[model samples]
Target: MNANIIIECKDLGKQYKTPEGERVIIERMDLAVKENEFVVLFGPGQCGKTTMIRLLSGLEQPDRGAVRINGKRIQGPGPDRGVVYQTISLFPWLTVMGNVEYGPKVRGIAKKERREKAQHYIELVGLKGFENTYPVKLSGGMKQRVGIARAYCNEPVVMFMDEPFGALDAQTRYLMQEELAQIWEKEQRTVIFVTNNIEEALYLADRIIVMRNCPSSIKREYEIDLPRPRNYVDPEFLRLRKEITGIMDKTL
Candidate 1:
């Protein structure tokens, strides 16, 4: 691995047994993500994007290859990798502060210390006034903000986001994308984001890796050199979007 590479997988493969037959989801896929780089995995639905995140984050093991982070092979989930999901899995019973502080509190940090750390992240995610609010009280976008804060509070070196904004209304999704991009610009981390939205990918990614349909592998890679806070209608943006979409395998 290159010295700058923070996470990498080599010759990765995965499959599953089903009543119909064995199904392959990923095959001979290899990727390396550099430190503090925002890389987006863009693909059609059911393209194993989530599985790739799980494999890289150590939530699941690859059947035929290995994932390494900072020169160490990953065995399982660790504090070094954080995940935010589309479902916004915040503890419903826990307040925003409680949810954000959960990781540090479980790791045995002092209450005052963890609370301070959690407060910083809450404010960072633009939820300062909602610290005492529960998940049920949050809007869809706010709940995802809490999820992002909770993940960031862990101070993970890498963050794997599996379609974190996919469930939001279109207007809200666009808002969250801008907010997330701003947040990332303020506090950079190695981010591996999964999404099927071409505009979202172009807006947030330093590089976008397009994936093939099920039994997925990299179909193409685009280095997005466009300026931050990207214009959705920019000529280059539309050109790349159209080009990428043109090559994608259509879903049924």
Candidate 2:
């Protein structure tokens, strides 16, 4: 409940009834995210990374413990948190401008004001010229751009991204990672991004939390002190990457 800590997950635990039996996905996990901190949740196996995000973001309730944002316990999903998913869930019928403005529009923001705000975010995500384009016509990376813009247009206090770039091709994935890092640099937000990609995690994260698989908990944490626009092949970067990989390799 510190002033600078925008997010807190205390002794969080969750269980699900599976076909086999009751399955525990999270186990008494504790986490705190500082204001405007970019944190990545990385793991080797199918840790409950997504489940943790859902619980924290209020998409699901933990059977025990709590998730707090700004010292208040989360009850359910709200505008203060914006989420981008692996599927790039854009409105197929809506154009880029329409989709980005959807949240504001639903919240009764005036058309002119929302349009101006939407335009700013659209340009910010490098999609100014494609305002009229629909999701069906855009490429994978471009659609994710729209997703990011749409999330930003809400002006959320925290952004929870669950593998937003996981499905992209390698070249496009790398490009999107670079672009996302640049975007985060310009517009700082408390971002909790989940991914299994170590390079992507290192490139974008201010701190990386390595999690243990199924019945997950934080195994290790690394504060990345390297400068922005980090080089993948930099010796220090490689060394850290190797160290992280070695740590997670045990979970396999």
Report the C-alpha displacement of residue 181, candidate 1, in angstroms: 0.2
> What is the lDDT of every predicted structure here?
0.94, 0.93
What tens-digit string does per-residue lDDT give for candidate 1 at 61-106? 8999999999899999999899999997888999999999999999
Candidate 1 ranges beyond 4 A from true positions: none
lDDT of 2 by residue, 71-119 (tens): 9999999999999999888888999999999999999999999999999
Return the lDDT, model 2, position 119.
98
Reference-based lDDT, residue 8, model 2: 91
After aligning candidate 2 to the native by TM-score, how far in Å is the CA of 65 from where it should be? 0.7
Candidate 2 wrongly placed segments (more than 4 Å): 249-252
**Which pairs, if any, clash in model 2?**
none
Query: For candidate 1, what is the total of clashing residue pairs?
Result: 0
Worst window of 10 by summed lDDT in candidate 1: 243-252
Q: What lDDT, from 0 to 1, does candidate 1 have?
A: 0.94
